[model samples]
Target: MSPVVVLVGPPGAGKTTVARRIATRLGLTFRDTDLDVEELTGTSVQDIFVEHGEQHFRALEEQAVATALAEHDGVLALGGGAVLSDASRALLREHRVVFLDTGMAAAVARVGLNGNRPLLLGNVRSQMKGLMDHRRPLYAEVARHTVLTDDLDAAGVVDEVLRLIEQDRA
Candidate 1:
């Protein structure tokens, strides 16, 4: 099954929210690999990171993205770091992928310092900065489209994604 669209971005980039809205507007289903991983392990993402470590979580995320990319037929939102996997990046090249780009201030404000995010542990802004800096290229390398979400609301991002999907259909 081929996904209608796949969304990739750094954490706090509004991927999930925008995907849900796009799915609703398009009358398609919404699937998030992060939630899939949680269901697969019967635990929260934070717990997985805390208990099994980032490598383990990344493995699960990679598998989740692989399965979703191969099997899902709707709007799919991947975990922020999913593109870090070469296999996932290659698979993403076969589909319509959108990267929701955001600025550091917006990402930090959206994510916050005291969230359950596993990557933003001690110093949220600094860690998020590092994460975004390191992963931006990976996101760009696999994405077919990139929408800056720093100024737009979720609806605005959804509008852009819908436009991208329509362009793909055309």
Candidate 2:
């Protein structure tokens, strides 16, 4: 399979939205690892976290990401926490990984205190802050390019990504 352009970021960084647009513009398939995990397990991510726990969910996520990297020749968006695992990070290193970086305020504004996000269910602002602090370095380590999404909309992010990809090619 051809190499993939993988999107990795914290939630609300617009990975999914930007990936879809980029995939359309570039004529590539769009695959979200979280969605793949959900489909394979026949349950929502929230349910997986609630019932089976984060560890289990992450195992499934690892598998999903590995599968996407190995078999997909397109745009792939990984779940926010996917980069935490060494296995996932190793897989990402071989692909064109884009890190959509967003500040805590922007992330909180975009994700809110939605119950859908199991980790941010309580004190979302603080949780998001902590998450960003913890995961920022990992995202940076695995990503070939880092796109700041604090002020960029989905279209703007896609535009920036396309520019960066073109630059990489050049």
Candidate 3:
């Protein structure tokens, strides 16, 4: 199987952009868990949150992660909360996982005040901070490498990840 790299981070941490560049540079396929989940469930994630609940959405997220891990050998960008699930964490441990660490301020700035993010609907700043507090440690736990994305562009982050991968290989 081709090598797999899993990118984990909170929303707006530039995981998708970095993953896309890394996948392109490495000549690997790119998969986004959110996109796949939406495609599979025939519903947008925000709608899923509105119709069901976060628990149900997380279930789909877990399934999406599993499917991506099993079927794809490339750079995969996981939903911000995917690592909250124990099963997802376990699966991630089996592959090369990179945590994109971006501060809440930067994340909020990047994501903006988007209502589509159910978790960030009301009091987004506080919610983002709280989520980061809870998720950052978990991400560090599963990450084989961590790249601070505070001021880095997508290409810079990709280069950092590539260097980390090379170091790990060595």
Task: Pick the lDDT winner.
Answer: 1
For residues 90-121, write the lDDT of model 2, one tens digit per residue.
Answer: 87888889999999889999998788889888
Sum up the clashes in candidate 3. Answer: 0
lDDT of 2 at 10: 98
TM-score of 2: 0.98
lDDT scores of the candidates, listed in order: 0.93, 0.91, 0.90
- Candidate 3 residue 158 C-alpha distance from true site, Å: 1.0
Give lDDT tens digits, candidate 3, residues 5-117: 88999989989898898989999889999999899989999999999999999999999988888998888999999999999899788899999999877999988899878
Candidate 1: tens digits of C-alpha lDDT, residues 1-170: 89999999999999999999998998999999999999999999999998999999999999999999989899999999899899889889999999999999999999987557888999988999899889999999998999999999999999989988889889
Model 2 misplaced stretches (Cα beyond 4 Å): none
| Pairwise lDDT winner, candidates 1 and 3 | 1
- For candidate 1, the lDDT comes to 0.93
Minimum summed lDDT over a 10-residue window in model 2 is located at 1-10
For residue 7, what is the lDDT in candidate 3? 92
